[model samples]
Target: MSTETTLIKQHVIDPEICIRCNTCEAICPVGAITHDSLNYVVKADVCNLCMDCISPCPTGSIDNWRMMPKAKAYSIEEQLKWDVLPAELSAEELAAAGAEVGAAQEEAQAAAQAAASSASAASTASASGFNSAAYGATIPPWSAAHAYTNLYGPKAAEKTITATVTGNLRVTEVGKQDGQQDYDTHHIVLDFGSMPFPVLEGQSIGIIPPGVDAKGKPHHARQYSIASPRNGERPGHNNLSLTIKRVLEDHDGQPVRGVGSNYMCDLQVGDKVQVIGPFGASFLMPNHPKSNIVMICTGTGSAPMRAMTEWRRRLRASGKFEGGKLMLFFGARTPAELPYFGPLNNLPKDFIDIEFAFSREVGKPKRYVQDALRDRAADIALQLKDPNTCFYVCGLKSMEEGVVMALRDIAQNAGLDWEAIGGALKKEGRLHLETY
Candidate 1:
């Protein structure tokens, strides 16, 4: 076997920061990404470093990379089992490992060469063919107001800040009388007393739950999007709101209560909680006058959308800003399960155009946010062609593909070149996706 030494950069997910959003997995073109209940992992051998999954990741956990000998790279199984990423092998250790696997090193070298060549070829081609527009905006809209991010957290001097739980109320209607499905969601307000915690509309905050997990390690912070405007949840106060769903079961329907959700849901007034972040610099709304906004979301994904909408509402109410069209396509299992249903109805039709899609509404055909988009294809197509229009998609990971495909269909049906339009959208930062 040839003794060619091959160096490769191995991408790994940071388990500590990852929220298990599945955004990276869904956007990965080569199926190099996969996730378990606890972790999202990248298969090193399959990943060609296309950089497609990097931009859409909400937490920046998917940005970790380790450089080592090709033969010493971690496998998918190894990554899935890791609680924390393994320390990078030293130069001597990498050399020893490579030497031990003589034939394996040759195989790895071949694979590395093949992957590099493929990646190079892909780099030369236009990325518009990959439907990257669906992955969402990596950069905020050009006209967006200044946002303060990472003001506090792991990267900052202060480890964490404390916030008082000023308000906690159930947003979704749930009870035996409501239905068999007891889906619970809460609108939580946090007040940062005498502290400077500046946050923008699309940013998120990390809530550190009280105790340790089953592994006996301190529970890592969980991120929730800011659901209220920058001014405050109630206006002119140092506070923000979050829309948190009480997760009673796992994605597989197994009875596993979520750590953070349960803790946040059970919070009482005046209770103090440890907080971090104001994470996310992208996925923000346009602040320029008459910049049309389109929001598509489901469940708690409505948090950021609500923030932007409320901010717009506040701006419109002030009569200082002449706003543009505001359209929302929100989805849920049913009307009762939808958060902020009653309040959403009270908004004037002239201020915003709202459409709800409920997949499990009794006696009605199943519908989703994508279906709503399709129903309004002509209008969406017109918006897509507008230079001032910006689109945002958030919610479940399952919705990303369908919503993106709907945009593609809309562009095509309108006699527009999807590649050109998609390229322009991404280049201009007009489309953003935040599905988890």
Candidate 2:
């Protein structure tokens, strides 16, 4: 009388040959591989057997095998229900995790204070802004003509404009929500009219303009991930919106301005700015029936998170999506710097696991997103068990190592094989890093 269709089971990973890259953890459309501080295990129920995670492994350690003949097949409904944890953690677990974060916060605060004092002393002795000569050579936004043409196509009509004192555009909405500051959220409207360029979620676009930098030279074209989902940028619509933040400093602890970010931050609603590209290849989300996503980011890196979340939210509201778990980890200098603070807090807190690490806040000395991951090692490890889980990390490049280190610690603490877990992550693009 029961008409539930059974799903097939399989052994998609070969332990003997696995190199432990953690790729599978980050790439699986569903969170299926349970990775810890030690070993990466596959959770069969959530595994769709799509085999999308096999190709990215560098050492070919993953081996896909059918479930044994004796094993009972489970229905899709049953499979979907397999890994759903109670969404409740014991009071002890929550307390321990909170304590760990508190300690880390203190350390981070101390370090930030030290750095701030040093910076203040240095600033008093020198010019407030960056010294243009320190950098190898500065280029104004206008000099990058080639970058502009490449993004819009070689034959596209070329238009150039410079940013001036009177013409400078002030930012308006910095994407604010409750418990969040009025951060710099600038909205740009792109009117495609009849010649609109379309983009999907996860796609990136390039921007090249004619503005000159402080060095009296043209600046370079910059690339940013398209935050708007494809559905939002539909045809016949004259405009597209982009949420951007200005990059104020370079990675080397030196004062340097980002060409695109600075210009983007200073634009008005009516400003006609040069635009190019939607250029990215390996970092898109799968639109498969029941895709799972594990997103990790720091700072303004939450842009992509916003895109993917918005897309999923739309699908959920329509009741047409057979979606999987959506885990998001976002880090920032302080709670104040978080991009989508209020909305992040509002997401079905049950479905979306939000973790925070304030690097400069008073309590912590140098805490980061990775540290938060380590604190939640058990839950994270369990998520990795689902071979369908696709993990994504974006934000500061410096945070990559820390995150990896935290994963390693989680594996060790959980008795997982570190090499195997890490290998699977890299092999499956489960450990995507997009820090620049």
Candidate 3:
């Protein structure tokens, strides 16, 4: 058929500097940016010139620039694949090239059609669905093919940034408030500026140390959610904090060394180490005003919860945050492993509702966070009545099934259908689960 020309732009992405975090690809407004193992590039035809993809790039690897005029303008085939065969190439080669181009055009057409139709239709809501919009399957604001490269022409990448340990990385704060022997919580403050590391609240980073396991293989990186809010650190400088638990060895009782937690806990103030990331987008907390938050977590899963809670606390302290209620449900093994136990308890009861369940506490049967949730079924049901409430669940990967069951039960006990509420939560991006 025919093609229409949109604005021409280039993404200046420097592979050297790019962290390959995929943030640019994740935030693209159109389905244009794509990548192979080596590089990420923009599809000229699909580029929308939105330029929204640049800000989140940490290394500033993305640069949007207009195509220069009077430059050597080559056809798509020539510009893309500079090394060309003679026009006398075999018929088979010509046929393959033609077929490839035809396939690409067809795919683009299909994507465009999906975008238009999905935007107009009502999508099905389901627990398995990524977004109800996908039910209708509309073109998402961001897609796998879309990337930040469209606005900024690709450029040379800078070196990937890494966290260096240079200062006192000791456990500055530890344990619960009021001498609660019930938990093993610790608020560890790492001096990043002296060590000079920096991070954001919702962002996560990897922790690793030099060592091979008993199996003789080097350990892989471990990602941890940053407990401190972005602003908590200086604009370009700050301290990092984490609430960690020392995991028990295996069921066999052999001491299992945690790849990250053990390394973090073992560090002295003067020790140096390697750290990477601040990874995750789906886990980010909404910063909108009047937004309500429902946090469901167990153990160190409370890391992000702490970040969100403290951010709100800071805002409230400024006497300007007049927003929705923040409900927190934290769980741990026998209460001894629930980090931030004391600070969480000290929050004004009016501003937050804290619920705890000790899954392994002695004489009584084990009561998990899910059980606590069941007890508060009425409260959860009422709070969920406000569509604005965002629900977050985090902790051990194994706890997911139990927590989900608890949510379902909470729905059933409240006289509301689980499927409907669950679907609504997913559709509104209110229900978030982070484990493993």
Write down the TM-score of every candidate.
Answer: 0.88, 0.57, 0.60
Better of 2 and 3 by lDDT: 3
Query: Cα miss at 75, model 1 (Å)?
Result: 2.4
Give the Å shift of residue 183 in candidate 1.
Answer: 1.8
Please list the residue runs of candidate 2 whose C-alpha ends up more than 4 Å from where it truly belongs after superposition: 1-189, 212-218, 233-239, 254-257, 363-366
Query: Over the stretch 269-366, how does candidate 3's per-residue lDDT look in tens digits?
Result: 56655555545445566667677788888877888898888878888888988867888888766555556666677899988888888876668788
Worst 10 residues of 2 by lDDT: 132-141
Ten contiguous residues minimizing lDDT sum, candidate 3: 135-144
Model 2, C-alpha of 46: deviation from truth (Å):
44
Query: Could you tell me the C-alpha RMSD of candidate 1 in Å?
Result: 4.0
Which one wins on lDDT? 1
RMSD of each: 4.0, 24.2, 11.2
Candidate 2 global CA lDDT score: 0.53
lDDT of 2 by residue, 102-179 (tens): 443354356435644553223222143321111101111111112111235212325322211212222333433233
Candidate 1 Cα misplacement greater than 4 A, ranges: 1-5, 98-135, 154-158, 176-181
Candidate number with greatest TM-score? 1
